[model samples]
Target: MQFVIRKLSPNDRLSIVTFSDDAQRLCHLRSMTQASKAHLEDLVDGLGVINMTNMEAGLKTGHQILDGRHSNHKVHEHT
Candidate 1:
């Protein structure tokens, strides 16, 4: 995660998609900045292992998040 954060440019946008059997959603999207980067760092620090593994549900949720992002940025003209 740290590596990912480091590789992001200031113009980059990122969203965190978290999932579990009982809960799944796009945590949020933020532009990379000093504060935003710190926010990502904090999120990573607070992470905990989910004992209930549900890969299918997690993937579905992630796909939904990506779809939403794509739709939301349609004006940006995603090809």
Candidate 2:
């Protein structure tokens, strides 16, 4: 797993993080605080990692459901 993080602005406390899988596919994009040491630590900890994995799975499932609904809609339109 790899992540790329960049500050939204020089004077801002927000940053954008791009999380990539082993194959270099972008799996997740998120905004986080740049000034919170505890939050940052939690993100790298074991529990946080597990939570992130679960969230990723949920996100993928959501996309699949949305795609199915979109495809169904297209079919109904053609009928």
Pick the TM-score winner.
Answer: 1
Estimate, for each residue in 1-79, the C-alpha lDDT of model 1 and write its tens digit.
8779878989997776554443344346678887888888788777777766566655555565666643322111111
**Model 1 quality (TM-score):** 0.68
**Once superposed on the true structure, which residue ranges of model 1 sit more than 4 Å away at CA?**
69-79
Which one is best on lDDT?
A: 1
Please give the CA lDDT of all the candidate structures: 0.61, 0.31
Lowest-sum lDDT 10-residue window in model 2: 70-79
Candidate 2: where are CA atoms >4 Å away? Answer: 1-30, 36-38, 48-79
Candidate 1's clash total is 0
TM-score of each: 0.68, 0.21
